[model samples]
Target: MPNLGKLIVHERMRRGIGPEPFADACGISRQTLYRIETGECEPSLPSLRKIARVLHVSPGKLLDLGA
Candidate 1:
């Protein structure tokens, strides 16, 4: 399966957004964003939605689910 963490990093870099600022824009802590990006924890639905909105992507794009 494609790694969700890698995907998040890829998209974030592609958009030229740093982790701290991105997390701030998403209304989440930098540590939480780091954990999510490192695959240490799964994001809650609300968190995922916030991320997707800030990243201009669909939440499904951040999920692995064998896609």
Candidate 2:
């Protein structure tokens, strides 16, 4: 696998958004976002959409296997 979680985190960082603030904006806890970024859990479509909104990125970018 190409580490989807890292891609998410990397994109967030690239966009200058923090996990806590982004997750809060997404209505999810910071810990949960952290887990997603850490590859501890996979996010569902809705969650991915929320995260994409928070990160100011497209859902495809967030879920891109190539980062």
lDDT of 1 by residue, 28-58 (tens): 8999889888989877889888888888888
Best by lDDT: 1
TM-score of each prediction:
0.86, 0.80
Q: For each candidate, C-alpha RMSD in Å?
A: 2.2, 2.3
Off by over 4 Å in 1: 64-67
lDDT of 2: 0.79
Q: RMSD in angstroms, candidate 2?
A: 2.3
Least accurate stretch of 10 residues (summed lDDT) in model 2? 58-67
Local distance difference test, candidate 1: 0.84
